[model samples]
Target: MIRRFRLAAVLIATTAVALPGCDRPPEEDTAARPPAPTQNADQPLELTTDSGAPLESRRGEWRDALRALLAAPDADTLATADRRWRDLYDAFNRHYLSLAAQACAGDRQAPLQRLDAWPLYPAYVDALPAWPDSGIVNDPALELSAASLRRQQGATADGEVALGFQPIRLLIAGAKGAPRQAKDLRAEGDEPAAALRERRRTYLKLAADQLQADLNALDRDDGLSLTSLRCALETLDDRLAALQTHRQATAPEEGLYIPSVSVEILEETQPKAALTQLSADANRDARAALESGYPGFQTALDQAVEEDSWAPLGEWLHAHGD
Candidate 1:
């Protein structure tokens, strides 16, 4: 099952570790989770490991590392934001896609197994303008998942829920809603639901711990390749484009995932303002690198212009290359 708490912690894992009476073995012990990728003194930090479970299994590990970098007291990443860009891209991609895949797995109800009585979900439903009839709401397997949002507890008219990453994302992002029920972790049945839920929490914490340790061991390599820098520039351009498109097309009250996901949900922060600010920050960070040397700069500039990417940036960089 996959569960996220206020967007800060999302845990998705399978099984309880050995119970004297249970057939299922204990959850995989993470004590030996892979060590951090070895340092490449030539670059900031290794973005990924050569060997691991697919991106799905290693995301939390990466997020922890990335989060630590962001929190580092040394502000040196400012000079080499390309590395941060690289890390953010991998972390964002892995996080967005993997959570959906892992949580929606196995009966599609797996993610919701533990949310049976969580409090915030009901409030989340009552407030929706109108449920999206995206077919996801009607899945039989999600009956229990939707029941958690039953507004009136037993009301048949409660809002329907689709298989969504947004609600969970909102949860993780420190949105207003939070789990209210007492979580039980005792190993109950041979295949106890309780055990898996507990294991998810344990697993998530371990993954976070692992990531932090990796971050502490990593160092910034100022000599990233030209190609890597160009890639980072393009990534920021892509994100800005997509986000602008979404913001323009989405309605204000729709809870549509970003910017306007509601100040109510955000509590203290403004994601809308922050998105624009981040794009600007990333652009500034990449500017020096993007404009670094001459002929290579022209080639990178040409690619940006040819692709019709954030044209203003391309034109500006092309006009000012050293």
Candidate 2:
């Protein structure tokens, strides 16, 4: 069963907040500044799986592809990375994430899962018409520091996320509604402009590093329980229901990752064929874990999939019992 759910659509709550000033201009001795980290284009990216074979996790594949894209950023690589992200997002939402949530529910050592699925706000990562120079790219305070990047996540009153896939998206895609050129990223103009360009490049590198770090954190068995997988599912269901109501009342802001929202609506309005596949996949994985002598695997999964406010899971089970 191949369950391909679309990536979750993010809801952006807007607010009127004062923008900060750009980072102070670089010092006169620009040569003293540390060079941005560089990756060797010739080196192959290393990806390891639990079985020590080809990588099977979509998340791992996306991470590697993203690394490659960051190493030699170009239009083609950016497109490839975006495709990989979509694949990862779909697989995670439909199957792997559920499994992780269930595991976390039953075990104390389970990896921590993101509750909101790290939704991206384009305005938080890049400049939008209403808030030009509003994102991490233009903010000198966030430039070139992993700590700063991590600290800024969910630190705003308006729920603007400072880290994650969206910042990387803007890094590769340029500003919100503009074509990115090679020259735009290069430091080729006069002193002030060139310094800004250099800062942008440095920020891009830092953003990619921070992204990779976040992904790595998800793989750690750090005694972090993300509560029951059912909680996450129920939360998502509520969000989807609210989204539908919001759309009916008033149109959502345009250009806010509309494709992802559209995909969610399509899944909701369509048949439950995908849900069957998802159930089968979940069952198979649970059995496999049990066969490998993992205690309580089946029990945990059974509890996780129990009927709740998650409409799709409930409807599917009502139509077809486990």
Candidate 3:
């Protein structure tokens, strides 16, 4: 089970393998052991139990896994943390769907709780910046989720208004990270509250631990989180070139990287790929941000480009920041 108060693991995953582009110490060259399988860009990248496992930063498997995911797209390789997360959700969906059928027994909305209506909703919400509280914990399935988080953290009834990482991650990993499906709350009528509450605790221990472990990888030194910056950079490039047409996305940690990178990156974070989505002022700001932030990374990216492989980006991140 996840112990919420547990100290985060500080070490990166260890490995005996070595990658070609990166130049680091013997102990630091923790590449994926057998090399990741190729992934197909056009396919919906299927995830199995092996692809969604949790990780410790010290062991650094998460880093290895991340490199694998980014490096190969027609290959079926997965990082430890990614695999663990997907597996957890695959299991949760089965359990959650079953609970929903029971909760709704007859109606599709037997049990629902609107957390935003609670008097202490504001304070309850401020506590979880990671989750975008929908303000409503609909159906017995979500009600149980909120209750579990509250009990684990020893929070008040008002706190039971929101779901935590365990639930949130399930949503992110599924449906391409789209908004939660519209649940039927108008059909609310009857449900077994006691049984549902009990059921919520069944996977609480496992789910909590998994969520915490992944959280550690992401919060401490996650390659997935860092990779977002790379993706965002590509988006920034497209947006700047067209000025009148491209869309712009803020790099991961755009604000944090302001002093280290460029302020224009955040100057225009809105996506404006087409003319319909364009804004003259915003585009100008985005262009400026590209100029500002591009300098710091370009020197490194240029170095990598001349080498003809993207591998140097990882080495640069190692020397600079995530």
Backbone clash numbers for all candidates listed: 12, 0, 28
Tens digits of per-residue lDDT for model 3 on 170-272?
2222112222121211122346434432332333333344444433322221211112222333322322332222112112111100010112222222221
Candidate 3: residue 143 lDDT (0-100): 37
> Candidate 3: lDDT of 62?
32
Comparing candidate 1 with candidate 2, which one achieves the higher lDDT? 2
lDDT per residue (tens digit) for residues 1-322 in model 1:
2121111112112111100101111233423222222332123211222212243334444455434433441234222322433333243332221222222221222222222111123222212223321111222222332233333231321122212223332222222332212232232446545544344233223323433342222222333433344333333333343444344322313222332332222222222222232234344433343344323444544454455444555334224333
Which stretches of model 2 miss by more than 4 angstroms? 1-64, 99-121, 174-176, 182-184, 187-190, 220-229, 242-274, 281-322
Number of the top-ranking candidate, with TM-score as the measure? 2
Q: Give the per-residue lDDT of model 2 (tens digit) for 161-269.
A: 5555445555555543464555546666897667666766677767656655545544443321212332333333333443443333211124233234334633543
- lDDT at residue 132 of model 3 (Cα atoms): 33
RMSD of 1: 18.3
The residue-level lDDT of candidate 1 at 93 comes to 35
Candidate order (TM-score): 2, 1, 3
Query: Model 3 off-target regions past 4 Å?
Result: 1-166, 169-187, 193-298, 304-310, 318-322
Each model's TM-score, in the order given?
A: 0.29, 0.54, 0.20
lDDT per prediction? 0.29, 0.43, 0.28
